[model samples]
Target: MESGDLLLYKRAMFRLAHISDVHLGPLPAVTYRELASKRVVGYVNWQRHRRHFLHDGVIDAIVGDLKGACPDHLAVTGDLVNLALDGEIELARQWLETLGDPRDVSVVPGNHDAYVPGAFDKICRAWGPWMAGDGQADPVGRYTFPYMRVRGRVALIGISTARATAPFMANGFFGNGQARRLAALLDDAAGKGLCRVVMIHHPPVKGAVAQHKRLVGIGRFQQVVARHGAELVLHGHSHLPSLYWIGTAQKPVPVVGVAAAGQGMGGRNPPAQYNLFGIEGEAGQWRVHLERFGLVGAAVLPARIAELELAPHSAQVSLSPH
Candidate 1:
């Protein structure tokens, strides 16, 4: 059944907590061999700048506050580690444990998590359970990108745009391969009467980021959504609170970008904030109540943003598929 044909319940509700770009700090020591590739540039930048902005205490306070709210599920949009070092991945694993159990958390990788060639594979191995699909587990319990996990009436789809890039570039790509699979996945989930949420690290809209840090194949990603459609899109690469609309088969999908969860207040960078979304309403008329929580003084508290109605409006014009 197509999503348009499904009958959705009016009061069915789900609460989700979204935090991204943690960039978990104080990168571990790297050997000369590790810095041979792109690590050298990242290392230099971290030492000179990132170390101060991405604070451990800030993230701890933010997580502590999130736990107090206790949403139904947690979605981390990536950049958990700065360098993707062996130790960094392990450290992120321990941090994930602190956030929540694998069963309650869904994660997707970011450009920083796959900063080097072999680091992508390393992330898959270490963060497998967090990104696993809804299907039966493999004998080895391995994971693949664009994985889907169905939680109650919602289907959380995880897509990876995190691939190693040359120095000075913080870009991501959703190639034709992932695009095709994503379209099918969205359709399947929608047909099952699920509220589809696409989780990716990079924004799928053109000009969303600098040329060197943008999602390279955003056109392909947009095309897939235009054909299949989704209820909500959650991403984290820009490190700013943002809301954009993308054209889909039945409506304009709302793509939300969150600020870096661990960032401190002293710079041009946005302060640490996480998004809370209350999803409710029935088929064809879903509503997402959005609340942004940020660091103020020593406390992480609610910064009520806006409540959004996500379904396509009757008189709303369709967005171009650029």
Candidate 2:
């Protein structure tokens, strides 16, 4: 090939690493005074169940493997703490520093991070830096939903579906307020010839999670995609590996969910894992290589999972029911 052809043939690639549901462990000592609200029940639940499934060793192994690959950016989809206690939030901040700088790591909270009625405020205050909206004024130190972070030609959009539910529910909500803003954001990103990637805590597909833990107003979320369109969507909180398609104006948007980053053996949850996406090509023709890394035996390693091809814009599309 000639020099000019060689230059044109070179692929411009960007790597993004996605992990969620870390549930950073060894909970801080909690006194009875702090458990007055719904946290009392959550504290008991953590002591009984969460300690067994979420292992710090598993997180260490996964992080080690991810760092070896050296992704351009890391997207953490929350559940950083078990009960959203003050001490837990503070510890999570310190732990996030280990992953990378605040600018290099983007985060969105989960239901567990906002486990109680008023704990959301504490979470916002503690994790504000990691969740800031792109080029938006956040004088109040609270992050607004649908935050956009542009890396190369890919646009990483973070949306929060986290909310404090009742004693037995782990539900998430994406209200009308967020939905309106999301449509505009996605449209703008697409107009600029950028690949739009929507990241949220809960899966947006119908029946993705159980009734008690489902994302309320998922139809609104779908409608926005149907109108504006996005290339990909990443989420956590199902604690399982999943790939589903949502309809958009051009092509179906691939929505992916990952297992817990700290899950170990002997549990209903899948083992600890994270996803790496290799994205190349321009807005009209994009190629994504999705790879999953997990503990095959006692060692964590990488494995190729799926190869996705998205068609150019101007293609006819329909509304996907699920």
Candidate 3:
């Protein structure tokens, strides 16, 4: 490449690392009082199957590999804890610290984070810094969804699909309120010529998860995306690596998912993994290259399992209603 082209490439490139559904564990002993509520089900589930799959060592290795890649920012799409136990929340906080400064890491809570009615509040308080919007103060008790954080040329918009659900349910909600706010944020980000990356815990794509674990307002969520358009969407809940397209054929948006970060080898789900997105180019013509790294088969260290260039944004157009 010529000198001018090389310079332009360097100027436009932004590397982002994505990981989710950590379900961080070795459950801190729970008391009979704590297990009195919905925690009982989750605790039981953890003991039976999740404990065998989700491993802290796997998370450590993934994080270590991700840091070595040195992406410009890290997007952790949630399920940071298995039971949303107080101790689990604190442990997640410490792990976040190991990842990077709050400014460098962005997080969104998952169904497990808000495992119970009051668990969401605890998550907001403890993981507030990583979840806070640009120029926003540390959330005291509550933080609104559809938060925006700009890093160089990208706008990381986080929306929470996390909510307390009845026992035996792992659903999420994306109400109309957040939809309106998200549309506005997308509009503003587009106006600024920033690449919009929407982050959510539950996959907005239809049939992405079982009926009980689906996103409640999936239609409204897609309506907003189809109307305003987004460069990319990242989500977690399925605990498997997946890719789906939303929006019109002319301006399709890539909805990407990753395997649970703490999932060990030989589990039902794929081994722990993360995605590295290399985004470059300007508003009308953008290019995104995805590099997936993880433990495959019986390998101990994470390796680059897949790499591909995503659909490029050849035109700056939106399907916004006239």
Best by TM-score: 3
Which structure among the candidates has the greatest lDDT?
A: 3
Give one digit per residue, the lDDT tens place, for model 2 in 46-116: 88888988978889888988988888889999899998988889989898889998888999999999898
Q: List residue ranges in candidate 2 displaced over 4 A.
A: 1-11, 140-143, 300-322
- Which residue pairs show collisions in model 2? none
Could you tell me the lDDT of residue 144 within candidate 2?
78
Q: List the candidate 1 regions with Cα displacement exceeding 4 Å.
A: 1-12, 139-143, 248-250, 297-322
Taking the candidates one at a time, how many backbone clashes does each contain?
1, 0, 0
Instruction: Tell me each candidate's TM-score.
Output: 0.89, 0.89, 0.93
Put the candidates in TM-score order, highest first: 3, 2, 1
Better of 2 and 3 by lDDT: 3
Cα RMSD (Å) per model? 6.0, 4.6, 5.1
The ten-residue window of minimal lDDT in model 3 covers 313-322
